[model samples]
Target: MNGDWLTRGRDGRLSVYQLSGEAVRCRAERAPGGPWTAPRQVGGDQRLHPFLALGQGADGYVHLVSWRPTVKGEAGLVHSTHFRPRLAALDWNPVGHPDKKGDRTGPPAVAVDAQGRAHVFVRNKAGGVSMLAQKEKGGWDPWRDLGGEDVHDGLAAVTGESGRIELYAAVPGGVLHWRQEEPGARPVRQEPLRAPVRPGTLYALATSADRTTLFHTGTEGELCAWRPGDKPVTLLDSAGHGPVSAVRCELDGHDCTLLAQRSASGRVAFAAYPTEQESAGAWWTESGPRLTVDARVCLATDEDGRVVAATLSPSTGQLLLTRRKDEPGLALEAWREV
Candidate 1:
């Protein structure tokens, strides 16, 4: 239940998905805070991977993509959609392996374009990347190979303010990027960007209409930022050990960006700064009881425009929720199990 597991729908209702055993479970918030529905099983139990990728389209539907063992014991992607906050999720739809050999692939990352097509990306068996996207008319287009070798497993994909999809993957010396020149078009690979990022820590934030900033833990654990053609900027001195969850929202009428990550000691750490103003500075503040087991924190803006963060209790396996208080400077309410 980490890495983009929480999604807020256009209706203002928030949906959180997590892997419980081999089955996917979903919890819904009527609005931002209280009276969240009890966890409901998404699909039948299967040999599904532990990862789940959640993406919301402009149409208000939340699209999910996950890997599950298919024929020959190789993993294939499965797709599902929750049309509305309180509605039952659609049945799992199978997206076969990228190649005919049923090659084993890594967990899939998804982004739905303005045209409502879901683009799924995964690290292929050959150490490169492959993508399978939905077609406008109805069905899905065949899997297309988006070439990149020496990349890591976790793929970060997001739709920009202009409705184009952009992707970032961490490689050895730097990061690889791809962006759609136009909305609903194939994402073309851009020049290899420079950043000594630790793989699996890459996250993308659409700070403005035409701009997306990539954030990741540097090879030395520093939280770093890089937009196309710009030199890498250190957002925080230390971002801890995993992928950073970020969201841009209006904080007290001023635009701001919020970040959350798992601290090195396994506690949830948070930071805030003015959007696109990396030089303004940000400091990490640790909160919540340190997890007794491994877990990650996810950030999203609630219906009330307050920042909402959630994570699983590794010891009890219960969901914990917290929200930013109305007052100044990213103050969050106490963490309470929901």
Candidate 2:
């Protein structure tokens, strides 16, 4: 499962780099077979932080959201836009004003359903979560609340097999998940399914192939998995290194989980576990090579089942991408600085 990396260049321009053969090669424009020009800057301020870029639907539209911090360090929405291939000469624009008076919104998570409708999830400083969607008719819908009235830490959105939408979040006390039949159904229902008993913050949450099982990691350095008919299991306890920073998709033809965690000394380590076992049932096994980089790592998987691990160099702060070898076991490609 090879994937590409996208980040803002030193000059404030969006840059694309392809991860292949354990090396990252810069693509002059976007990824090959992608738009010729990289995504345009959404806001005037080049100092804005680049959160994440979401792929467009079959209609050839890509979506992105980013923010700029205020004088006091509060993030404010700067721009959110939909890129259409037809509008090659166009630039991104800010979406609706979804944040409240003093609340700031986080980077948006984009999801494109089977119908080619775009669904975006945004988190606010007020602990609220909102969902915005673009219908097939080419109209932007109103922002709808999904977090209920609680404070949420992080938000994630994914499209299921039947094009159903699943939204997950880490709230103050536990994790919450909601699903809908369509892009804009009132979330159908919301439930707090997993509670991290240890002392730590929940950093990330991901689902298995069936989307029936959910996995999460907390600040206490423990990894947990939850399923419909089973109790929440602790797959791995970090001891004290801190929570798992990143998790990739399920490996091809295996019921296993792959995750990247920050150690006590801040080094990043990769671990894999069987998907069907409980956290306590199956001993969390560490697979692949350990990366001793300075900064935290992020995990991305391509459609073909390749995994790309990325982190910033602690010494120079330059981004690094490592491609794991395409083997049955955990074999990693060489690490290269992008």
For each candidate, what is the lDDT? Answer: 0.81, 0.51
List model 1 lDDT by residue over 1-338, tens digit each.
Answer: 32477888777888888777777888898765658898887855556777788787888788888777776656677888888878888888888877755646677788888888889888877788888899889779888888999878778898888878989988898889999997667789998887577888888888987999988888777888888878889876674777888999888788989888878777888888999899999998899887755676888887778889998754467778898899977788999988
- For residue 225, give model 1's deviation from the true position in Å: 0.5
Number of the top-ranking candidate, with lDDT as the measure? 1
Candidate 2, 124-194: lDDT as tens digits: 54567777777668777777776554545345555665566776666656767778855456565565665
Query: Candidate 1: misplaced stretches above 4 Å?
Result: 1-3, 44-47
- TM-scores for every predicted model: 0.94, 0.68
